[model samples]
Target: MSDFYIRLYKDSDYKVARQLFNSGNAKHTKKAFKHAMRQPHIWPPLLALLILPALDIVSFTTSIFAVVGAIVFLWFAAWRMYWSYVRLCFLDDMLDIRRYYLEQDGRCFWVAESGGQVVGTIAASPSSYPGGENHVELKRLSVSPSHRGKGIAKALCRTMIDFARHRGCKAVVLTTSLVQKDARKMYDKMGFRLTHNFYRPKPFTKLLDFKILFYQYDIPKLQ
Candidate 1:
């Protein structure tokens, strides 16, 4: 922790920061695929394939192929779902971090540097919701896998929170998914409260019970 420092993001940090973003998001896709496989509903279809062989409806070899194919399809579906979201992110604010965050008033991006490498990143912008005029949205937070557990993420988060405070924002808000267990725990420890959650309005997400969680940390207004 002593070796790392948090500072405003720079153009030079873009490449490494994008790598961290992709790596972090890739982990979520893997976790989501695993979670999808664990759902009770997923087993019934595979079980049916096995039962076909027992009932002599299909050869054992064909049943095996069907089960394996189903599993592969599920994996592919999960990957597609997650990466599609990532692509949209790339098309949006991430497409031009400077224009979206750095160039805008009351919004900024920060990175954690250690050994002259960017190990973590976080950004905050005025909330985009209809009635969130005083709120701030925390975005693009990622820490290098190798540098995690050393307080880099928490420190980056603190930087964003303090920035929002000084900017007179009412609260800091962030959204994380069910697969991001570590992030959920960290947010809880940092005094952010879980407000609500919802599953993406898609068949695959609904089937797997994949959910997105929203957390908020309200700042006390200055007297």
Candidate 2:
């Protein structure tokens, strides 16, 4: 059998991991939103207008008070929307790296090294619920753009699954957003099913246009 190595993340891998995550997120987000600008009715802006009424501090009984309140609310809303969008973009860029380096989980953090360089990572930890020994949570899994489609992610995932099984974890669960189609496909190929669909709306980022779906995977223990 060919030899490949996977291990826990180290402090030295932080910078490279951040770069990989940002680059991949940028590519994925752009590809997902390629047709966004072409839509006639921008959803974020419309939603902002609808919520203006609720922001009114003055009595809505008077026309003048209502109009002033609406104006003030819109100004703040627009500013918030712009800021939220910027933060969302930044968060998307840094998510994988952040989870890898900053997570408080203690089970394990696995990194795939090729030629002494970090190509991908998978982090897993035990479930927080009481008497949950038969389950583990795959928190964050990402592969560098340059090394994708080479089975790096799959190898890392399999390694984690095997480790979990050996530790008596009967199944593994993970969550990914709907925006990440490639990731969703990977999970499906690995036998994950769509267990839930939830909405995570961010109005402040001018991003009320999309909803994210959550996924779960139940991996059977090896015989």
Candidate 3:
């Protein structure tokens, strides 16, 4: 982190960001989505696994072909669910970076580069919800696993807070999953207070324990 430089995101940074985003989801999609499977919006395969036993009522096992058909259908549903979770949910913003992250007013993205190579990233923009116009959202903070513990994450977090302040934001907010333990600790140390804790019932009582936490950094009033 010592040699790294922080700068505004450029058009060229898109490729690296996209790659990083995809690699991140490709690696953790299963575990993260698996944790939230009870959420109505993710992982259709496990749902099938639970529901398939009921298909005995439909006589799916009546013939070898029926069984094969059921098997193929389950496989296809699983594939679709994986695709939806990873591409549509995880990488949705990166799918249209310019439109989502770059084109908005009061929006900005930054990258941490070392040796001319991008290794860390963060973004901040004004919130869209009512009463949040004065608030900023710090998002997409990613540091290469290899670059951990060198103060890069701290620098990026500080960068976003400062950016928000400079942008005249009253506060900056961010959300993270319970899985991001290290990040949660860092945010606590950085003076971000927990503002919300909620669970999404994606599909009802089936999947549980999908905890998401929101943190807020309130800017002090001017003298």
> Which of the numbered candidates is closest to the native, going by highest TM-score?
1
Model 1 regions lying over 4 Å from their true place: none
Alpha-carbon lDDT of model 2: 0.62
**Over the stretch 1-223, how does candidate 1's per-residue lDDT look in tens digits?**
2999999889888788878887788777778889998999999989999999889999999999999999888888788877887888888988888888999998899999999899999999888855677899999999998899899999999999999999888899988999899999999999999998998787688776689998999988788
Candidate 3: residue 163 lDDT (0-100): 76
Please give the distance, in angstroms, between residue 221's alpha carbon in candidate 2 and its true position after superposition: 3.9
Q: Which segments of candidate 3 are over 4 A away from where they belong? A: 25-86, 89-92, 204-208
Ranking by lDDT: 1, 3, 2
Candidate that would win on lDDT: 1
Candidate 3 lDDT at 188 equals 94
Candidate 2: the clashing residue pairs are: 81-204, 84-205, 85-205
The predictions' CA RMSDs to the true structure, in order, are 1.4, 8.7, 5.9
**Which pairs clash (backbone N, Cα, C closer than 3 Å) in model 1?**
none
Instruction: Give all candidates' CA lDDT scores.
Output: 0.89, 0.62, 0.70
Comparing 2 and 3 on TM-score, the stronger one: 3
- Candidate 3 residue pairs that clash: 38-207, 39-202, 39-203, 40-202, 40-203
> Which prediction has more favorable TM-score, 1 or 3?
1
- Model 2 misplacement above 4 A: 1-4, 35-106, 127-134, 204-209
